[model samples]
Target: MKFMAKIELSRHIPLVTLIVLVLCITPPIFATKNCDFPAIFSFGASNVDTGGLAAAFRAPPSPYGETYFHRSTGRFSDGRIILDFIARSFRLPYLSPYLNSLGSNFTHGANFASGGSTINIPKSILPNGKLSPFSLQIQYIQFKEFISKTKLIRDQGGVFATLIPKEDYFSKALYIFDIGQNDLTIGFFGNKTIQQVNATVPDIVNNYIENIKNIYNLGARSFWIHGTGPKGCAPVILANFPSAIKDSYGCAKQYNEVSQYFNFKLKEALAELRSNLSSAAITYVDIYTPKYSLFTNPEKYGFELPFVACCGYGGEYNIGVGCGASININGTKIVAGSCKNPSTRIIWDGVHYTEAANEIVFSQILTGVFNDPPISLDRACYRK
Candidate 1:
């Protein structure tokens, strides 16, 4: 009779060497062709703000969300903003504002963006002035608090646990940024020359990078950072500085140039960050190109009145008062109202883009043609 001898591989191989062998053969989680982003954590200003400003102060009045939602939804656009389209593309629920306490569900993620927010802290906060108190630093602090609070609430294992994001969602989520526009605008509004505004770009970009680093340190790996758009093309900017040089598209050339400079510095800083943070997937999205294109060729993209406000009082750009406010015009009270057709207009309320414009911007950006390193939003999870 022959007896079979058992052979144990673990006995002969060292524990550390066997562990290394196992790790080497296994593929990284992000190496998969299909990159799944479980949630979206966003920080920005009005361009992507869902409702942070509104919750902290007052919501925009009627006709703001009339184009799509048919009511006020606290978004700056006529209907949805770029962030709403982003959430829809991922098949996730729209992000609830972190400041909004009424019936907010953060299962997917939260938005810390606010209108008039800057990467650097503003001189005036809410109740004292128009600028938001939720600057990038403050937003990061809020995010940190959110993490700790949500973890504690989720650990209780009740119905609330289903409402909060899962523990793994933080690392698996995409972090978006659409700020820095206000930083430039604030300088111009403060009576600073274009050169002065340009001079401050480096410091503003540095503050932005610092906030990103803080967020990255807190388990954020996937990032979609949007470059500031062409503020010069905004109706308010155009109307405010009628003497400024205008491009062929009627946008203020100097203001737009300042914005381009900011984007340039931001891109350079992000490139350095990408090299340093090798594990992070940081994408610099060129929001300026697509937004500027809409202004230059509004008709090409089924848009008209590119520089005109869809809901303002008066002027060549149709902006004299706030979108939904009433003003006394020659002893007669008149309310600022939306245009007959908001879908045809590019600018919504002298500042933000209309829903139609937002959709167009989203479509163009999703193609990855306007993104640095040329990666689409869906593929943003993997480092290039």
Candidate 2:
């Protein structure tokens, strides 16, 4: 409910210049908890992306990671993402990106999340005639390949390969999914009407459920599936659809309706999956309510601005340009900058969440309340 006054000096400075100054002045925070989980395998879009897409994306640069790592670590936030917090909670090291070959270590599992990843391969509807290469299906293939190679090495008596128990790793490891946001958003952005997008919900949920089934067949038993959040509250959505009606919390109402519908179907599909895979402890995480609550009552969660982007360039809500956009000032190019207090903001860079927001959501997920069947990650992991 409270808003920080825009910095007068920053208004005159180039965005890039302001970000460099902010990064230099800001100090990183270090806080982690201990929990019990052998390993975590994450697959999703930007919310869980730990840099697997950095090689082909722009998030692995300054400003994006300025708040947390002080530089890009391939995450789309100012600090550690939700998956990072989950890993740290279990006393595990930050999962390495499956794409990064340097010092590849699978001892603690690998993150297959990539920014802009979608649920379907060709996308529900392609607006730009482009398909994301790292779809959920592709990420799953990468996971299968990683496990296969590791198994082969362990079988051949390779040293250090035995650190991960070949037979139990996949079965014991926790599989967490945070996808589906892109599929819905892309559908809307591609000029698909709300009705048309709604029509694709069954197919989207089908693909998602099918992927879970495939993972289950591959030996995964513990699953933590995150439902799509309220995309209508995203700064990017609001900016793109200025005429859209606002909800009680000032978010775009129509977009959120679509998101709710998607979550409903996803939850139903997950229920059916649970029935089919009786051996799998599948928990559907309701990410929408917790995240939407933060926006509705920002003060309750220590956030000042819930809908505005902390890092962006040129727009009413700072959603016109991406976090890394650059502008020329008097023939000299200056990069777009971020907010001074990212911790006080909910949305980060128009599309992602700040580390603070992620922490809050992570806490909700840990409590077991947001999960279907009311099972926490710890319960799902340790259950026999």
lDDT of each: 0.91, 0.82
Best by lDDT: 1
* RMSD list, candidates in order: 5.4, 18.2
Model 1, TM vs. native? 0.91
lDDT of 1 by residue, 1-384 (tens): 123221266668888988898889998766667567889999989888888999988998987888888888789988989999999999999999999999999999999999889999999777887788999999999999999999999888898888889999999999999999889988998999999999999999999999999999999999999998998899889888999999987999999999999999999999999999999999999999999999888899888878889998888988888899899979999889999999899999999999999999999998889888889998999789
- Predicted candidate 2 versus true structure: per-residue lDDT over 1-384, tens digit per residue: 123345666678899998998888776332122224677889988888888887554444578888768898888898988898888888888888888776667787888888878888863322354445789998889888888887887888866575444567677788999999988887888899888999999999999888888878888888988999999999889988889999778999999999999999999998888887778888888999999999989999999867789988777888666787787869988777889899999988888899999999899888888778787766765322
Q: State the local distance difference test value for candidate 1.
A: 0.91
Give the poorly placed runs of model 1, Cα more than 4 Å off: 1-32
> Candidate 2, which ten residues in sequence have the lowest lDDT sum?
28-37
Candidate 1 local Cα displacement, residue 59, angstroms: 0.3
Total backbone clashes of candidate 2, pairs 3 or more residues apart or in separate chains: 3
Residue 159 in model 1: shift from native, Å?
A: 1.8
